[model samples]
Target: MIRPPALRPGSRVALVAAAGPLPPGGVERAMDRVRAFGWEPVAGRFCRGRCSGYLAGTDDERAADLDAALADPGLDAIWFLRGGYGTMRILDRIGWPALAAHPKALIGFSDNTAVHLAAQRAGVVSFHGPHPHTAEFPDFARDTFLPVLTEPRPAGVLPFPAGSAGRAEALVEGQAEGPLLGGNLSLVASTLGTPFAIQPRGAILFMEEVGEHVYRLDRLLSHLKLAGVLDAVAGIAIGAFSEVPDEGSDGRPTVRELLQDRLGGLGVPIAFGFPFGHVDDNWTLPMGVRARLDAGAGTLELLEPAVAERG
Candidate 1:
């Protein structure tokens, strides 16, 4: 994938709330974080506007705001404020041709997976990382966010904070080098048969989720299997699956077991638990950049500089 222009310090970045309403005190924290990164944060008008029960604004309003941000030549990036349930609502409304012509870094996770897939379709790389609302204002956000976004090269050997565990625990120990793809399993699976289905062949596929029952996770995996998504990857990495209740040794397969059962036979490198997902310390990963996944070493290293600096 072609990298968009790198966002330099003091660049103007737009903060958009394309999903749920911005929670109380959320935007302030994100703004502070953005300032810390040395970027001027231009909050979207819709970011603070509330419409229905959960959305930030009307579907048209959200889509239009995003369109304006993309079309603005001065905007260096479009960082999503938060993700809940509104992006799909404005998918078709996006002016794809315009976005393709004037690409910018569009970052977020969870509900923002739709936009990531859309960016891929538009032939631009999108960020699958924390949002300003959740990631910007927090301390761990600085540890992961700043390096990945501001540095000239993709950070090497993503390090998890102390006490945090990734999903794959020594499963299929090996290494993989390829572009990074995949996001929340449910979101990726939800795109099946849709035009935005994940295309992860020969790429390092990373996945994580939150608040999902083991059965639901299994079903999503089944969907990927049925759609042949699992068979087309070069390597696999599983992030933290949070909020899953303990099954109490009922003999039901855990999420990791299920992953191994489905992906192990592929003969590719597989590792779990990389300190990513819907959690604090969510490291920012560029979706289309080449990377090496060393399961034996428990590290995912970016193989190339994601952005080029023009002196």
Candidate 2:
């Protein structure tokens, strides 16, 4: 994968709502944070509003905004306003090859996974990081994020903040290293039979989800299992499965129970709860970088730098 240049203090970042429509006041909020981060915020034509439905605008307009950002020689990076349900719809509309000529950091996760897959195809490293919303990231997320993008050094071993039980827990015991890939479970599952499917032949798959029922999660994982995705990964790192419902009592499995049942038989390193999902303390993961997963220790370490260092 091609390492993009590190973001500097005076960098210019373009904010576009390529996925779901922005919530009211979201653009102004994000613009404030962009300035606080020391980058000039350039809003796309559709960035400030929503359309008739869930999308930020028509596919053509959204595609134009994103394509413009990728083709612009002035913007240092492209950061999404938010992640919702429209990115996958515009995959065909994106000029994927243009990214190679003007490689820059592309940020956002969840529904944004589709874009990340396309960026990976273009051989550019992209960040599975926080959005450019008005809300300030917690100290943990902010501190852990800054160095990875600005330093051009390997993020090295990610530090897990202490928790009541533990920051991370081992589900399967072993150690494996590979390029980290994967985002939201639903997005990963959606790509199973598509041209943009995740090729997990030797990747450390990281997954997280929110607000889904156990049965749906089961179906998604089952799809991966049937497709040989579960069997092919070098390791698995699970993050927060936030705010899922625990309703209905038909002997359904809880999230942890379901995970163990689905992933335990793989004989690969597996760990859960590393704080990178729909939460306040999210960790920014650079897709397509070498990372080490130590299941016994429940630790994930970056094996290589995520960006090219400027002299």
Candidate 3:
């Protein structure tokens, strides 16, 4: 993957809302965080614009904001404001060629997974981390986020979240190395059969999701398995599946059981309850970078830096 240039303290970063609109004061809060990191924060014209209820703005407007960010020569990175629900609507509309010609680190998770996949397809590495609009940026997240983007060195070993000893399990124990791929499970599953569908072959797939019912989660996993994605990966790092409910009425297995049933026999290292999702302690992950997953050790280690050294 093509790593973008490492960010400097005074680098200009553009904040754009590519999915849902930010809540009141969300943009201001994000700008403050950027300043705290010693970077200049620039907002896209339509980042705060709302239209058709949930979308940040009209599809064209939102796409334009992203395009402008990509085309700006002075901006060192583009930080997505928040990820709610509209990125898929404009995935193809954004100028991928322009972005590839002038690469910059694109950062966010959830709906921004669409953008990350698009970046991967364009041969650019992107960051899967907490959005700038997060209500509170935990210290772990900020520490992880800064170094990955600013330092031209490996991110070191990332262990499974603390307190996960009760929930973390090794389904397929062993170590596997491959480029890191995948994001929100629902977003990854949604791209099936499309040009943006995750290329999981030879990848250490990482996944997380929120608010999904257990059966629906099973169905999504089933879809991936049937599509040959499950069999193609080198290993799996399962992140948090927050708020997943047991409908109990259907007599279906719980989410954890379904996960084991679907992925246990894949013949690759599998570590569950990784700490990168819609939670307080989310860690930043570099998409498309080669990584090593050790299920026995409950650790994921990036093999290379996510950014290029400043020239």
lDDT of 2 by residue, 13-109 (tens): 9999998888788899998888988988999987865676788988888999999999997888899989988888889888888888988899998
Writing each residue's lDDT as its tens digit, candidate 3 over 166-278 gives 33568778999999999998899998888898999999999999998887898899999999999999999998888876644478776667788999988989988788888
Worst 10 residues of 3 by lDDT: 159-168
**RMSD, model 2, all Cα superposed?**
1.4
Higher-scoring candidate on lDDT, 2 or 3: 3
Regions of candidate 3 where Cα sits further than 4 Å from its true position: 159-168, 247-250
Q: What is the lDDT of residue 284 in candidate 2?
A: 92
Rate residue 24 of model 3 by lDDT.
Answer: 95
What's the lDDT for all of these models?
Answer: 0.80, 0.88, 0.90
lDDT of 2: 0.88
Model 2 per-residue lDDT at 33:
85
Error of 2 at 33 (Å): 0.7
Question: What TM-scores do the predictions have?
Answer: 0.92, 0.97, 0.96
TM-score of 2: 0.97
Candidate 3 displacement at residue 37 in angstroms: 0.6
**Global lDDT of model 1:** 0.80
